[model samples]
Target chain A: MSALLAVDGISKSFRGLKAASAVSFELDAGAILGLIGPNGAGKTTVFNMIAGVFPPDEGRVRMDGRDITGKRPDQICRAGIGRTFQIVKPFGGLTVRENVIVGALASCKTVADAEREADRVLDLLGLADKARQPAHALTLPDRKCLEVARALATRPKLLLLDEVMAGLRPTETDRMVAIFRQLNRESGLTILLIEHVMRAVMALAQRIVVLNTGEVIATGTPEEIAADQKVRDCYLGEEAA
Target chain B: MAMGRATRMLIGLMVALLLAPFIGNDYLVSVLILCLFNAYLAQAWNIMMGFAGQLSLGHALYVGLGAYAGGALFFHYGTPPWIGMIVGAAIAALVGGVIGFLGFRFGVKGVYFALLTIAFAEFTRILFDHFTWVGGSSGLYLPVVRADHDNLLLLRGRPAMFYYVILGLSAAVFLICHRILGSRLGYYWRAIREDQDAAQALGIDTFKAKMAAVMLSAALTAVGGVFYAFYTNTLYAESAFAMHRSIELILGAIIGGMGTLFGPILGAFLLTLLGELLTRLAENFGHGFEGVKQIGYGLILLVIIALRREGVWPRLAKRLGLDGEKAS
Candidate 1:
């Protein structure tokens, strides 16, 4: 089957700085694809483009064989593409349940339906106990979980995670990696994760794409990409590989 | 999800609405009427400032424009004040739409957005001040009516009519805001408020959402303005769009616990009564009261912010309720 999502020749620039240039990749159903890059290498920019934060200056993004480049973010989300932010943003005034309620409402046809779905997600995320807590009060890892939970509440087919594992401890990261693997295995949710954490990416990603200075430098299975000389030169030092 | 405290609060509001007339004296009734007007204005302001996170420092512009458009039509064309009120509200909505388009399109935010709104209000005030057709700088006034004539057609005859009209409006506004705040539209507004770029990434049309809120809020606030114009039968550019009015509306919401349905009503009632008491004290103490009311307002605001930053009622309400409670 055709790749579930195709990022075709996308390019984005900000104030003359090339954040992403002619970058292209594809993700299949139930796949975990890792996107890694140095700081300011436009990893988040590419993620932003895919999530419809801003349209690419060039090229198209396709999902399920349908072109969705430059579409509104909410429309892209409703089209089954959900994403977590690099810096988790939550509604401070809303309870944990209510924060997910925002996502549920965003995905649902009615308030009553969304509220029901939100309740289910609250329980499923192991956040049922904290359902009534405000989003701002949670510790870093819980807030990260809240971000994923909020996105998952949208019932997306494709979940984009941006640095979700960044601040998590090793144990928490391992647990989240397991959860991510489980999500892909059981839910059949395609995931495209951007991370600098090698262990988490290696634990979860089936395929990894490496980028440097706004261009794709390597793409292959995690092991193959790790062994590539150019990938080492760009991301890992020779020793890291 | 269960039958919790927010629902009870809503029920309490309903009960209070039904019983207010019986329990309140004439002066208290007048005070309540003012509270109702403030409540409506505060709610409308909440839609823009509270939900959308667009701080407006001159929302009083809508009220002034609304009062003028409706009041002017009644005085100049022999039209009923009720019809004129609609005209006023439309004008205010139109103005709001224009500003929203400009502000959102240009990505104006925080203090800049506030300054822009203040400038707009000032500009409108100057325009009205120069326009003699609406009585100019001398101010506009409707003819005094015969006592107890109860002229339903004029919408000008009775305090009870005005009171009921304002009450119904305040209730309607509350329910409408509550419904919208819980709906998908509310999510969009909150997303935009909390994180505009994030919301856009989720495919929300942030510009359109903000614009819609601005118009709706402006129109509804103008509705209150229409009531103000007819209830008191006078209008002036300076007083209608005063900076103090905008501050009062926002202060009421903030003090009451912004983002909640009942906060505005509570804030309005408290402030209006407090002001009334202060004024009475000033009167009893004799002339040249100076700036005691301003000092009182300043003191009360500081106390509230120090005691409860999010709001007085919100923290208290949260202990027993879900709607206004701080998350986690």
Candidate 2:
């Protein structure tokens, strides 16, 4: 089967600094890919390029064989790419349901339709009880769930999650991993996640891509990645030390 | 129940506004007209600043552009004020579109964007001060028709006529604002206001949404400008496009409640009435109270910011059980 998303030789720079350089990856439908890197390893930058936050200096991003490079973020979203920020971007003044509804409205023709879709997504995320509460009032885990629920409401074919488990406790992280597993297995949702939590990555990702200094250093299954020398020397080794 | 209560309050307010002119005192009617005019201008300014979260400290640019457009047409060509008003609004919208396009397309935002607006207003004020066609610095004046003549077509000088005209305008603007606050565009604007990047990530075209807000606000403010020109029979670049005029437009929205539909109207009424009362007191005191109104405004603003940061309307709405869940 063909890949659902193809990132081909994408590179980006800010001023004189190289953020991402010629990074490439491919994910088949329903596959979960874990992106692991050290701090400022350009993982989020890669996600930004894919999500159209900014155009790459050189490269192409393709979804379902259609070139989507350099489109506005909103256009890319409507073209079926949904993402959550590393720093959660909640509409602080709006209710949780309203935040999701803003996402749902991208696909819905009317507010009623959008609200219904938002409610369903909120229910799926176990956030229905907090639907009317303002987003700023949410706890961190709940805020993360709200972010996921908001992205999911757009019904994207491919989801880009940036640091979803960053601030969660171990139990909370495990619960989220279980939810991710269910979403991938049952709904056939394709996910590309950037995670610092190695256990969650190892448990959830079918394939892993390790990045260092804006370049892909390793790509393999979880066991193979754990055994890779370069990954250990560059990333896991530093983490352990 | 909340929706019903809000609707009832809105209806009651409309009825009260409709019946105000029947009080039959010229001074009171004139004050009421000024109150409605400020409310209309505040509503216009609110759409851009409150709803879209674009701070424009020089919105009088649109107002002055509009006043000049309408007044020039009427004075130069003998055209009716209604036609002039439409043309004036269009001119203001065009200018707004240009400013918005320049700012949004080039990525000017926040306080810098506000400075851009101020710069534009200041530039235009200087240009209008020297432009001979519109009477330059001396100011432009509409033909002074007697109050008894009551030329509805020309919008001639009559306190009652001006009162009803502005009252109608205030009500129409209120309905338009209500309709907009309930629509899809309103949601987009609110999202953009809260966070532009997140709004864009959620598939909202933030630039277009904000531009729409700016243009719509400019168009509406221009209409108010036309009303001001015709009712007062005078326009000067300094007074029409002044920074203080822009502040006056914004203060109503801020004091009543920013981002709420009724906030601007409530603020406008409260401020105008207070100004009138203070002026009356100053007259009675017979000296040294010349700047008391300005001092009073500053004090009121300080109090609002310190005590109730959300403004009066939201608290009032909550008390009356009319606070809807929607952000607006």
- Give the alpha carbon lDDT tens digit for every residue of B149-266 in model 1: 6776677676777778888889888878987886778888887887787666555778889998899889988888878888889888879888788888887888887766777778
Using all chains and alpha carbons, the TM-scores for the candidates as numbered come to: 0.92, 0.96
Per-residue lDDT tens digits for candidate 2, residues A1-241, read: 7799999999999997999999999999999999998898999899999999889999999999999999999999998989998899899988898889999999899988999999999988899999999899999999999889999999988999999999999999998899889888889999999999898999999999999999999999988988888998878875542
TM-score of 2: 0.96
Please, what are the lDDT tens digits per residue for candidate 2 over residues B1-328? Answer: 7777777777897787778778558788988998999999999999998889999998999989988988999999988878988998898889999999999999898899999999999999999999899999999988886678788899985788898899889888888988887678988998898888889998999988998999999999999998898988898998999988998889999999998888998999899999889999999999999988888889999999999988899998888777664644
Model-by-model lDDT, in order?
Answer: 0.84, 0.90
Top model number, lDDT:
2
Model 2 chain A: lowest-lDDT 10 consecutive positions: A232-241
lDDT of 1 at A59: 93
Chain B global fold similarity (TM-score) for predicted model 2 against the true chain B: 0.97
Task: List where candidate 1 sits over 4 angstroms from the true fold.
Answer: A14-16, A238-241, B1-25, B318-328
**How well docked is model 2, in DockQ terms?**
0.82
